[model samples]
Target: MEVLGHRGSRVPGPENTVEAVDAALRAGADGVEIDVRRSADGDLVCVHDARLSRPAGRAIVRQPTEALRARGIPLLDEILDVWAGRGRLICEIKNQPGQPDFDAPRERTARALAERLRARGWTGPRPTVADLDAGAGGITVSSFDWFAIEAL
Candidate 1:
């Protein structure tokens, strides 16, 4: 059986946050499914809702990485840096329900993801960049929006 964490067992930590990812790894899960979103600066963030303030009451949309870093919520890169080679990160892209622009967010999300993979050299050697042109790798790209899927 594939032992995947349910939003990193949300009861123990914030759903889709790095704390949850760590909790899942400690719990011996073989894989983790994380929701991805494009932050204000076009960087990828591991979060479910478009607005981070929804649950924590902290407005995070359109905030740059440095400002977000001070909030303690790790970015996509920070999370992967810790567990990139330990197990699998099932990245599920989130639908941008309300946004100023559409295509920009999607492309930014993709590029941010690609950058993460490239940073750790996982794009060429490992499970990252799985959705490129056959485009095969280890990453999994999924979404409820048909437009997003078609974009990939």
Candidate 2:
């Protein structure tokens, strides 16, 4: 059985941070499951909540990457830089409930994710979680919001 870490084990350090990812890998995790949300500046952030209640008092969609980083949030690229090709990534795209322009967020997130993957040299067709979990070298996107998944 593959041992996938939740937010990179989330113990020795904050969830989704580079440190937590390293910790999980050191502890024998084959891969990690992380939450991804788009920030105000259209950058992808690795976080679980829509609102930054724990990290800050602002909404994640309204906070830029710089601001989120100041509050200890990790950018998706940062995590990818650390784990790319080393382990599997189960990326859970966060949903925007009760937010106006819900579809916009999904679109932006998908675009950013696609751009990042392409920039990282992924030229093949998008792969599924089963593919990545079966040893594909990139990421697999998932979401609680079926609409978001469908939009991708």
Candidate 3:
């Protein structure tokens, strides 16, 4: 039913990059699946790994979102822009499983991205952001960490 376009990218380019996601959408994908994480400054980006350096090469672990944007990695807004009318989306929030950054304010990251998508509305037959009780659509909060879910 849902032929999800995995990550817009997995390993080829930057996972979840707008370019990667746009490629999938153009190839007849019904929706996009992407990973999200908070940057050092608590900004959300479409990064799959726990740290950008691991997949990105080098050891720039705690780079700010703006730095990643400058490198053209892609912020949430960029990803959405590329995937607009193409299809649905499965936003998987990255939990930074092994390497924990206690300093990262993940809750704020989630709420921020959630609010952004909510403002966008679905612009579709069943927009994910439309028809919600509050501006809480487009965001499906789920994680192994119960505390995290509760935080959202």
Candidate 4:
């Protein structure tokens, strides 16, 4: 019965931001769900929309991570660094076909995600609850794109 916060509660700060994730944890959430997308420079960023409609009015795929960060979009690494060994993290890769950053058969998003997790020492079998309680934490990757999931 772990309580997971949707987009890090979306109350203390903007959804998908590092601030929100921290706030959710402080509020006693067992874990958090966040959206992941790749920027033009290939950096994984935390953002739900394909486009920054309100502030930038441009597709996220067209903007480099620096530009996106200037607009308050947190990088995936930033979130991971802040929340490492803290709790569970469910990262929903945004690679839908209709989206601007969609990756088809190549599934670059999934590949990159795998590489990132591997670099973080997330190898072998999935971590158990005891592992999480012991500060190893936990991670779950999901996506609407079946191909992406298969690629992972």
Candidate 5:
């Protein structure tokens, strides 16, 4: 079994930041499971919330990638680049029921995810790995949204 870190380890730094992810790897995590969400400009960002209440005081979809990054949010691509050959990545797409942006018209989200994964040459069905470093270990996208599952 693989020992993956949750949100890049809940120990050092913020939950989903690049710093935290790197720390997880250093601390002996085989891989990291991070959250994925779309920003206002359609860029994929690493964050667990559909909205940030304290710092941004706004919805995540309403903010751009740059602004969120300035506030400490990291982009999905950044994580991918770093983890490409070093470790595995499990991407959990965030979708909450009753949320405004979590409803229909999710094709864009699916497409964006596909594009990013494809860029990294990650395709085919789900992988079964004995360890995180086994095989062509790329990112895996999972979500609670049934529609998203169907769409993807």
Candidate 6:
């Protein structure tokens, strides 16, 4: 069985950060899972909470991507850079109701994810070994929001 690290082994570093992902991989994890959210500017960021207490209780959806990144929050692209092609990457989209950045019928978050993957040259239901060998990471997108999944 493949051993995937949840939140990239939060024990070693802050959850959802690049450091945590590296730590998990060093510890022999077969893959890593991370949470994804959309910033106010529509950039995908790696964060689990809708509101960040560490960043002065600011709402992630209201904060710009650069602002969050400056405060030590890694962007989704950063996490992907560290984990992609090394092993499996599971990105869980955070699009729950009551949270900021929740798009009802539009599924903007999901659509954005699809576009990002497409930009990265992901075109199949799943990446084949050849794709992985060609430096495309094996990725899985998941979300609690059914609409987001449907959109993906």
Per-residue alpha-carbon lDDT of model 4 for 1-152, expressed as tens digits? 78888999778779998899999988988889999999999989999999998665688988988999999999999999878857899999999988889988898878988999899887569888688777566889999999998998
Which residue runs does candidate 4 get wrong by more than 4 Å?
55-57, 129-136
TM-score of 6: 0.88
The digit string of per-residue lDDT tens for model 5 on 9-106 reads: 77777888888888888897778899988999999999988888776458888887888998889998888876765567888878767664585555
lDDT, model 1, position 35: 77
Task: Give the alpha carbon lDDT tens digit for every residue of 51-108 in model 3.
Answer: 5553555322378777877766677777877776565677776664455543234465
**C-alpha RMSD of candidate 2:** 3.0
User: Which residue pairs of candidate 3 clash?
Assistant: 122-127
At residue 52, what lDDT does model 6 achieve? 80
Model 5 / residue 77 / CA error / Å: 0.6
Arranged by TM-score, best first: 4, 6, 5, 2, 1, 3
lDDT of 5: 0.78
Better of 4 and 6 by lDDT: 4
- Which lDDT values do the candidates have, in the order given? 0.64, 0.78, 0.63, 0.88, 0.78, 0.86
* Most accurate candidate by lDDT: 4
Q: What's each prediction's TM-score? A: 0.71, 0.83, 0.70, 0.92, 0.86, 0.88
lDDT of 1 by residue, 59-112 (tens): 455667677666665688777765665555677766655543244434656556
Superposed on all Cα atoms, model 4 deviates from the true structure by an RMSD in Å of 1.7
Count: clashes, candidate 5: 0
Inter-residue clash pairs, candidate 5: none
Better lDDT candidate (2, 3): 2
lDDT of 6 by residue, 1-152 (tens): 67888999877679999999999988988788999998989999998999988647788988988889987889888987888667888889888988877886798888988998889876577777777556555888999899998998
Give me candidate 2's TM-score against the actual structure: 0.83
Which model, 1 or 4, shows the larger TM-score? 4
